[model samples]
Target: DNYNAINVDRTEQIPMDYTGVMGVPITFLHKYNPRQFEIVDGLNRYTVLDVAGLNDNAVKNHLHMTEIGGKSTYFRVLIKNRKVKK
Candidate 1:
């Protein structure tokens, strides 16, 4: 289940300036408050991806592909904050 763990390094640096869709670590769910954020489809959800207008390349770049031991890892939960934190 480590693969599904929250990536602290990346999550800690999440930008508060953006209001659009964002990909976050699944661990974010631990502290998630539904009233504050909305869960969107993840990378594996093709239908949702199409609706979100995210292609393979865009998703890879936007998600900030990470490498572990030289292999790319995929573990994210797409989300959108109901209210952007100032």
Candidate 2:
């Protein structure tokens, strides 16, 4: 898995078929359910490298972090839906 960021305005937009790590808006915490989802990590440069098993110098330009057209995104939480269909 690329472990790339998946930006969405609403939590409902998160794809249920996707079992890989996804970056969701922080607001998702309000409706978070332990049984349905697993908290992976926060979507940031440091955490992205950790989750990707990469060192600090492994990635340049912080590409692993949620960025769009060279611009960084807002705070996001990495998550995986346990109930996603296989």
Candidate 3:
């Protein structure tokens, strides 16, 4: 299955059905409200590994990784919408 990506400039398009981790542009911080969203760290390789309870030495190359349609996407800030129904 393909992953859905919301354009950074079009945040209003965020879907209500997904309550899991979302990778959004870093600039999203400007419009971010702590009450509405929860930051789940960055979407870079290092951070991704950290979140997975892994370390740098465990991985040879740490390319900034976020993917859509199995292609690498630009750097993103990992987040979860707090306002979404749980």
TM-score of each: 0.53, 0.72, 0.64
**Stretch of 10 with least lDDT, candidate 1:** 1-10
Put the candidates in lDDT order, highest first: 2, 3, 1
Candidate structures ordered by TM-score, highest first: 2, 3, 1
List of clashing residue pairs for candidate 1: none
Judging by lDDT against the true structure, name the best candidate. 2
Model 2 vs truth, CA RMSD: 3.2
Q: Which stretches of candidate 2 lie over 4 Å from their true place?
A: 1-3, 58-64
The positional error of residue 29 in candidate 2, measured at the CA in angstroms, is 0.4
Candidate 2 global lDDT: 0.72
lDDT (CA) for every model shown?
0.55, 0.72, 0.61
For candidate 2, give the lDDT of residue 15: 86
* Alpha carbon deviation, residue 24, candidate 2 (Å): 0.2
